[model samples]
Target: MKLFVYGTLLRGESNHHVLEGATLLFEGIKIQAKMYDTNIGYPAIELEEGSTIVGEVYEIQEYIWSSLDALEGYTGNPLTDMYSKEIVKVETNEGLIEVIVYTICDVSMKSVLIPSGNWIEYRSSLIR
Candidate 1:
């Protein structure tokens, strides 16, 4: 399976150690997607665009996806309310492919600030 990542799961991040070792089908490719700033010191996908926010797409085996799902707290339990998994098209080094995008629950994103819609630069500013 393939997935699109932008925030904490990005390369060189704490979670990237696990993700980088997996198969990556896209790198440095930008596409349209919405990235929102959450209070959790990270960002989440709020909405998707037809053609704005963009990131890389990666392909990994079931085991890697399982590990990622666990790390991302993607349980389908209605009470936990982590995120909903949806397939999104992303620009890849080779081309475009539909990859999983984790859009946070509406309630969880209600309190967010919804920055300029760029997760990477927003995060860089935060760290600086």
Candidate 2:
């Protein structure tokens, strides 16, 4: 199973710790989706075409979904409520493939700057 993480799960981010034992494919790549800086807590993701944002891709065991889902607060609750976890097409140095994506939900704004789309770098910029 392949997973695409665009936010906190990106390498060097706080949440990447959850994927400690998984196989990492790459730590660079941008995905197209509407990104929002939700005033409530974290961020938000929407289905938007041609919207470029950076992230990472990984190949993991299918069984790892449950654990990953729990880390992302999925399964029991609702991914859409916290973050919309969807399968989207992403390009890695290898090629195009379907990978699981955890996108933000609810908030929408045209002015939110996604800052490189690389969550780690984006977070770094937020601090500076």
Candidate 3:
């Protein structure tokens, strides 16, 4: 299964170890969605038309899905989860591909919009 990661799960970020053993399908991919900075110091992606979220896509082993789900706090119950995984089309250099993405299922409106759409850069600014 392929997964698109836009925040901490990306390479070199804190928490990136969760994706260990996964094959990196594409390091540069973008999806049409609104990116925001949550109060908890992490970035979240929300479904939005005509907006872009930059990230990477990985083809993970089937067994890794459970760990990934747990890491994202997804329990298959959308109503109470911090985030929910959904399949979305991501634009890559090869073309568009459907990949699972962990989106912010709640507190979306409360987050500050990340106009730059680059979480790594945004996160770097916060640290310095």
Which prediction has more favorable TM-score, 2 or 3? 3
In order of appearance, the predictions have TM-scores of 0.79, 0.76, 0.92
In the range 1-128, model 2's lDDT, one tens digit per residue, is 77877766666666677777778887667677756655443445665777766667888776777777776556544535555578888787778888878765434422365644544555567789
Residues forming the 10-long window of minimal summed lDDT in candidate 1: 109-118
Can you write out model 1's per-residue Cα lDDT over 15-44, one digit (the tens) per residue? 777685577666666556566676776677
* lDDT scores in order: 0.68, 0.66, 0.86
Off by over 4 Å in 2: 39-41, 76-80, 108-115
* Top candidate (lDDT): 3
**Once superposed on the true structure, which residue ranges of model 3 sit more than 4 Å away at CA?**
none
Clashes of 3: 0
Q: Deviation in angstroms for 87 in model 1?
A: 0.7
Which pairs in model 2 have colliding backbones? 29-55, 30-53, 30-54, 31-53, 32-51, 44-104, 45-104, 54-117
Model 3 agreement with the true structure over 1-128: per-residue lDDT tens digits: 79999888999988889888999999868888889888786788887888988899999998889888888889999899989888988777788789999988887534788887899988878889
